[model samples]
Target: MPKARRKPEALDGQHFEVVVVGAGMAGLASALRLAMFGKSVLLLEKHYVVGGLNSFFARGGRKFDVGLHAVTNFPPKGSGKASPLIRLCRQLRIPFEELALSPQSFSRIAFPDVDLKFDNEFGFFISEVERLFPREQDRFQKLLRTMEAFDAYSPEVAGDVSARSILGEHLQEPLLIEILLCPTCYYGSAVENDIDFASFVMLFDAIFRQGLARPLDGIRRFLNPILKRYEELGGKRRMNLGVKHFVTKNDIVERIELDNGEIIFADHVISTCGVVETERMLSSASQDENADDVSRISILESIAVFKKQPADFGWEETIVFYNDADVFRYERPDELTDPRSGVICIPNNYRYPNGEQMAEGQLRVTCLANYEKWVALDENSYRSQKEICRKAMLEVALGYLPNGNSMAKELEERTELLDIFSPRTIKKFTGHLDGALYGSPRKSRNGSTRFGNLYLAGADQGYVGIVGAMLGGVAVANNRILRGD
Candidate 1:
């Protein structure tokens, strides 16, 4: 059962052992872990709902998912195989079944001429890749072996290595390399052309080794349990409260002042807000050299609800990575207006824990976007631009659907609802400056700052995806707050 969220006004002079800012996955995980350890925890969120980037919004009697496409790093429930997320679940005491994870049927990566489908099973994925690129089978194996080195609980301390450099070493085929990099980089690329080796391997292990899965009942089904468990352990959550400033003494955060003018004391403060926002709260006078650069490129997402599923039109795969150009350019163009390459997800194709709801389907189409361009648009111009972009993006998305020609007709005819969320939406909802989907390229520090008790979690910590973000919270709680190591 989900616990009722309390208003921030209820907490005027509260004190806790630990105060966690932000109610995203990382903040939720941190509060849960700390409460499980018998520490009095106060979790705060500026938004009314939880999950932040991964959260959902409701409109016209329909609930639409936001940033969550799938749980990329899915650990099987009883397979006994070692999974990175399993450790976090164990520490958090969250039963795997509570997640209600449903593996993807298959995912398609499409280029100008080449189209490949990756199965959900690891063995099947390896077999399919080998079958498709038999000439480079040996190279594939070597790359897999090399990537395994990054399967640890912590980030690799090795000097930064780019994904491009790593792929070039193993394979000579440009298309194959682009295919491998497309999904991972799109999910969490800090750099324009390549991601750091640690991020590369993390995404590889999640999408390639472990495969993708989604909760049957959407994000609420997954989050409510954690919130329930936290409340059961005497943890408290105050919603609609934004941290205004941190009261520090001797380089340690001693208290937090909310935007509502309420001050609360805590021995330690863990911030799930990204580095820039966190730095702003610490003090306006303090300077972080990388604060401005923390946010990478943002995204533009269009969600279309239909009375019928794409599978009805012969589209079987749950996700399709679509590229129009012969040479894949992973970054948004300097102009930031046109998006030639993007991801298209049909959430209905997923195998739900329960029977399928073949009633209505959703197509979530996303592309890299420029936060600056989006935020600068006037009201009338913004609306006009969104409509134009939506139509263009829809045309491109239609081409990837099964029997795309006819599917486009069916979609236009049966469209129940359509909504476009820009970079500004992300920034407004998550409070991440510039609507950055992934935080700083710089890896998160070990949950510590100049102030010994102040720590960073969430995107600021350099982990992406729901599992990675939550684990970041657990790691920080264990290393900085709980263990004091």
Candidate 2:
């Protein structure tokens, strides 16, 4: 399909200065920022809700975050000087209560015998790390400092330093390496080759500062406000709306064609979809070479928002499990059983006594899954895919519970498939390049994407994380708006 060229002509329709596609956090953040700056922005989300990954679903009166479980970003100095997320929260006047994670530890790393607890304060966190890896204490501290430096490293301070450069090679603790890389690997990157040090730092910051806290109602509270805020600012959203492809002329994108055969024009199209899909949608020429090559990147899945009753309601806050560095994600799978280990993230157990909301109890389990297989099936086969996923989750849940099977059977009968979050899902729903949850790996030290006006953001450009994604939005928008693209 040929792209319709911008005529340098009169305004059509409402004349939006920017058209944001995909209502995920990145897109929502970008659009909100632009709107606050007084730009006439029109935001489009395929889903009914405004927040993409941040949205929630309700079943059995319990609402769980479909994508976002927790949040990071410290509250900042004072009222009006909070961090970006805080700023958005305040600007929207969304009243939120801050709750610290249970056990006063952010994450408990349990290896075969070593039980290391991580905290919100960086200094405390490092001290704990140093205690666990005493032999390499000096090197471990240096690694922590280096990662923190990467978090605060301004583009101006970068001063030609290569992004691919390692922080330091002196720390050789195999267990430390596993701990450091396991979280990064969840971003779908190769432990050795996929990420830059900046990404690692950003992720660490997120966990440390934003000790996992769910909203009062659940994950929906966070997103519902953001969606309301987006709409309040006059953002446009269409549920069940799907974009088939985009049209570009020369170096500029002119219009996006929806699956319903309608064309929506934009001065600029900021898609949350990834690079591979962007190339396919915006490529003016007619060749379809290497399309599926981009299609086949592996996906991470879990029984996201797995609902169940815990043995003890207080166990909700304390993640009572035996997950070392290798317990969760350790394999390439076409289903959940591939890795053989699964993670149970019990949010309600951390804090709070059971009141009226406590029906039986709230136990949330997420297993690393192979989401690609779900994409291969037709609608009829989806029911069977759900069964495979349910069984896989049950096997992993049985690791801790003596009565896990009966509980698992109860869940299998009631749980919903929710959504299939694959590369293609990210492509269609979020519009990220390569179905990248985070953006592509830096790939080179020079930091070039080999194209003009085409840039990366969210988890693509630098790192992949809550903070990384936010900073990615800032970086790409800087190139386009701040730098006069």
Best-performing candidate as measured by TM-score: 1
For model 2, the superposed segments whose C-alpha errors exceed 4 Å read: 1-9, 12-14, 60-62, 74-106, 151-168, 187-194, 283-331, 334-336, 350-360, 377-382, 398-436, 442-456, 482-485
In model 1, the Cα lDDT at residue 293 comes to 64
lDDT of 2 by residue, 1-485 (tens): 22233432355553455666666666766666666555566666677655554566555455545555455554423534335455444443444443221222245555555656655455665777778888988886676666655534345333223223453374776666656555444533422223445545555555654444444355455455556766777665566676676665565565667877877665555665444444555546444644443422344344423344453322322342334344334444555234344345555443433432323344444444444554566876666665566555556654554365656566555554443344445445455444444433332211233333334344334434453454445455545654553
Clash total of candidate 2: 20
lDDT of 1 at 145: 84
TM-score of 2: 0.76
Question: Per-residue lDDT for 259-292 in model 1, tens only?
Answer: 9998787767899887777777775446554564
